[model samples]
Target: MTQLNEKLTLKQIEAIIEEMSIDGALNKLYAFKEEYGTKVDKLIVKYEKKKLQWEKEFKRFEDMRRYEKEAYSEGVKYIAGIDEAGRGPLAGPVVAAAVILPENVFINGLNDSKKLSEKQREKLFSEITEKAVAYEVGIVDEKIIDELNILNATKVAMEIAVESLKVKPDLLLIDSVKLDSLKIPQKSIIKGDSLSISIAAASIIAKVTRDRLLEEMDSIYPEYGFKKHKGYGTKEHIEAIRKFGICPIHRVSFTKNFTL
Candidate 1:
């Protein structure tokens, strides 16, 4: 054991801890408790805490996928999750996403887009797309939003997203909106983004996609700070609109109440 300790560097110890399961880590901690010094002991404590947190997070993730598991039990194959972003934004388009994730799909750190930071959402967006059986995005610009009204425009976007999916889903788990027009069976859960893995994945995809579009729009309309607020009606955004007047992307209907 002393010889083994001499050969193991701090980096090597950390690497081993990273690869070990929680049980294995605990066994190693016990076996080397007396043989290792403070540095290794600290590493073990850190890894143990991290492993416990990971276990808790994984449990929550499984719980969030209860809707999907229920659908699977009902013999529904190819479950699609649908969600929309930018519905309440004062500018930019409302974007919707439809994603069909495979059964027993596991992606760590998946949660509601609103519950995550921009970096987390961006990372999950790529991960979801890579793992999804089929995914598609539908964008309805401010012009269409003004013409159709935000509610109808969002529904249209959702319809377009579902229709564009390469794979036909047997069931749709939606975030508080039923697509009655679509032939596919759907269940809309209130705040489904927080309760359903599929809806959460769809939320992340829609949010990331809309944020990207707003960033591009920021280049064209730097005054409104689309990149910063992502078209939300924050005081800064409202101030910008008031100073610059309505830009092309501003939904006239939404901003009509605003002094601008």
Candidate 2:
């Protein structure tokens, strides 16, 4: 036990903590606790809590990558994850994203887009696009959604996303739905956005793309508050539709019941 100066200020000790390995820091902190008193004890506790939290995050991240690992183990290269956004929305286009991520890529706080805040999604969106091997988005507007129905429209968007990828993926890991439009070898996982990091990355890209589009639509249809709800059928948006009538961005098939 290296004897830390009994009088060392917490700020000074904190600086020392940064220089040590996590285990070394914890040991050093523990050794100093009695001499430095209660504040030092609190620091030890805080450090432990932080360490535990980090462990949880790392485990979750590793678990999220399991599907990618499986694919990689099978001699697969260029595995892409597919996910879509705006399928349930009453307005705007259904957008899908296909993202190929580097094997064992470490991205902290990566998860399903629905599980993250808008700010988090936006941040991860930038991180993913920057670090991804390749990524592409497909957008199918409300008119086509009405024509083909949401499920088929979503498939088309996903097909477009896969087709547009700069690097064609050798394997596709999709979220809950299979794409028959493309003949790419694929696996679908239920709630895959939460189960697979690749799907989560694709989810973030699809969500951010669709949200930005809805925000752009907000400028055109100010009364609908598209930016706030991102085309979801919030009461505010429903009220706006009832009052202002359906706009071009509103899915005719979806809003028909609401309008009536």
Candidate 3:
């Protein structure tokens, strides 16, 4: 009998269930089979259906693991992914993250931060930080973003986050931007967060960090709806900005519907 508590892939668990059924482990079979009903023949079918669901989830993680291994090779011991959030927002800080995850750490359903729901991202964000070998965050405030322009400010923030890391990465996997000053080898992968696990991890970190900052801003500027939209120029945010004018965190350079 296969141990259910062991960390078996969903596929493996399904296989064990099938084998147990073939040998007529009724107690074990009935335990899982109860989800379907009491009919013996129906139970077999139910097991298959449930097994398929697990297989899909298992495959998702397996694919992610394969990519991590590929990147881990090529002499890249510490491959950090870089990404930023709050660039287009009219207020709050621009946040960036540099994350060097463990070589063997595998988390399911990690992808571009934009594609994930807030709940999913929050869960994965915690997992990444706990499991990563080294991680760092950089924040460029609204005033600085306005003064330096978003592109340059984003670059500065990214560099700061990377430099802040305790483990200096040998290679940088970035999303659509290159750092010329950092002599380390780098690859600017277009939509890297979707394609690379490391980049996806960075995206999650940057997003969560920036969201926390905006939440804090929300407390300070209660009228701006920073907590809801995280400083983005939504309808409510625009209305609030129009009513309140730009606060200390608002980007003066941005042409919000209403500005000081």
Candidate 4:
């Protein structure tokens, strides 16, 4: 076999690396290193780092699915994961999502919405919606949030989301809050979005849905920069509130401290 040398372009090596799975790519890189010690040195180092990253990510995804596996074992055919978004934002409605994913479903890069980049979350949002057995989103406007308080409003949204599911769930894996009103069996796991695949899917759905709403709100309240901060109380958002006063979408209770 001819040893690869400067005749082999870096781009060619990179393309080969991209086509293989993490383990396959790593093994091939190691073999290449053995054959052409310093010739493929840079490629070996790059793929070595990539292998570590892929391993860590795979472990995280495996851990996230533990809850779903347990539910599946216990004859829970449809397990819904529920989570909410926009709870802490100073503007926009609080949104909740309930998602029931197929048993043993695996989607690469699925994780808590907070742990993902915007682009990753967007990509996964579409994937989850398309692949889920059932999914529904519940949104409570700022008025309802202020009237009911964030906690109660979130509960209402969650319940609505659960009710909206086309496929009724046999079990509910909720993130940090159990709905007493819900007759379905449920487990409220703290940070379930990070610990449960279903909840992670719900978190992604809620986050993306609320973000899109806030983006539209940005058009109406251009002064608030909803598109940038997504209604979080950043210095810029607070400055906008102070400059333009509260918009119709601002949660009055949350913005009580502001002069508006």
For all candidates in order, the CA lDDT equals: 0.91, 0.92, 0.80, 0.91
| Candidate with more favorable, higher TM-score: 2 or 4 | 2
Show model 4 residue runs off by greater than 4 Å.
Answer: 2-10, 26-38
Candidate 3 lDDT over 30-90, as tens digits, reads 6544443443445556655666765786676556545457666765788888998878888
Error of 2 at 187 (Å): 0.5
Query: Largest TM-score belongs to which candidate?
Result: 1
- The whole-model C-alpha lDDT of candidate 4 against the native structure comes to 0.91
The lowest-lDDT stretch of 10 consecutive residues in candidate 1 is: 30-39
Candidate 3: count the clashes: 0
The candidate scoring highest on lDDT is 2
lDDT for each residue of candidate 1 in 144-252, tens digit (9 for 90 to 100)? 9999999999999999999999999999999998899999899999999999999999999999999999999999999899999999999999998788888999999
Models 1 onward score TM values of 0.93, 0.89, 0.80, 0.86
What candidate 3 gets wrong by more than 4 Å, as runs, is 1-51, 57-68
